[model samples]
Target: MSGAAFETIASLVRTRAGIVLGADKAYMLDTRLGGLMRELSLASLDALAAKLRAPGSERLAAAVTEALTTNESFFFRDGKPFEHLKRVLPRIAAARGPAQKLRIFSAACSTGQEAYSIAMVAEQLGLLPRLEVLGTDLSQEVVRRAREGVYSQFEVQRGLPVQMLVKHFKQEAGQWRVSPALRAGVRFETGNLLADLRHLGNFDVIFCRNVLIYFDAPTKSRVLSALADRLAPDGVLYLGGAETVLGLTERFTIIEGERGVYAPVVRMAAAG
Candidate 1:
């Protein structure tokens, strides 16, 4: 790809999604955008870059951004996070009134596995009615699939235990479908982490795992601070094992004895 074309696409992605794409990932432009390019009848990355630069290409711009996003997901990914959630959810529920819902946000919840996993945990604890799980991703395609709640055989086998599979899913035409009961407890939507998210309201638990590693330092700190603002004072934030708040922001502190679990730092009000 030409340097100009590469920078154009890279800038679009970074500006729209807060993801930093370096020259090392320049090769991905072809591999990832080939279908979009062909579908639009564009001959090369340079051509696609030109189309993207043209005014009123909002739809094309969105398509390119979604194409570049990594939607990799599976049920119960990195077992420890779900384990800690199961232990903590009931306690959080006990502190609230019976009618109050404990909301959990699964940010960048690709294909809905992480959100459904939370639903399964809530179901197992008989807390489904008392809880709500909202999964959001930048790609409208994955969000649609997640709302439909169907998974291929290969998708189910990835990190999904047989027992949980049998308990929560029913096979239809050789694919696993999440039970209506489980589906009812969760919702999926298309969202951008860098955009204003206040309308989504606050969350008692936020799972924003694995996506931050793709961002630059300033973007990471910005996102962390935004996440802190959305988190309840007592809420827990789950980050990817490799991601941390140590250098990014002081809005969160690691939960002692927990891997990947963080608590929002409470600010004290000054005396009158």
Candidate 2:
């Protein structure tokens, strides 16, 4: 890919999905966009860029953006976040009245593992009936798969415990299908972190793990602020091990004794 071609695609991705691509990642264009190029009958990266520049190419641009979005995910990834979730859920439940429903949001949830893992935790705690787990990703294809609630054997084996697997999944034609009980507790949608998300409503907990590493500082700040807006006052936000809020935004403060856990900053009213 030429420098201009790379810049064109990178600009589109950054604008639409808040992902930053450096010149070193130019090779990814050829590697990741092969299927998209073939599907669109595009001859080269330069040609794709030209199409993206055309006035009627909004759909092509969206396709390219989706093609480049990362969808890597696995069940109970890194263990600690879900463990913290186990402790936090009951506390939140204790605070709520009998008729209230608890809500969780898994931003950039990839293929639904994180959301389903949350469902499993709620089920284990006997809170599934009163819980709602929403998984959102920028890629439409992954959202479809997440809604389908099916996974290959290799996908289920990664970071998923044996007992939980047996309890929540059943084998079908060499793949595992998530139980209807779990599926009923969760929903999936296509969304972009940079876009306005107020329609999703406030979440008691938000898992935006492993997503901010791809964004620049400004974009990171924007996303963190947006998350803070949608989080309940006492809600917790979980980030990736490498991602943090330091030097990003002041809308959140770290939860003491919890790694990668944050709570919204409480602003006091002025004295009369």
Query: Pick by TM-score: which candidate is best?
Result: 1
TM-scores, in order shown?
A: 0.98, 0.97
**Native RMSD of candidate 2 (Å):** 1.1
Worst 10 residues of 1 by lDDT: 89-98
Put down candidate 2 lDDT per residue, 108-134, tens digits, no spaces. 998999999999999999999998999
Error of 1 at 168 (Å): 1.0
Q: For residue 219, give model 1's deviation from the true position in Å.
A: 1.2
Q: Per-prediction RMSD in angstroms?
A: 0.9, 1.1
- What is candidate 2's TM-score against the reference? 0.97
After best superposition, candidate 1 residue 146: deviation in angstroms?
A: 0.7
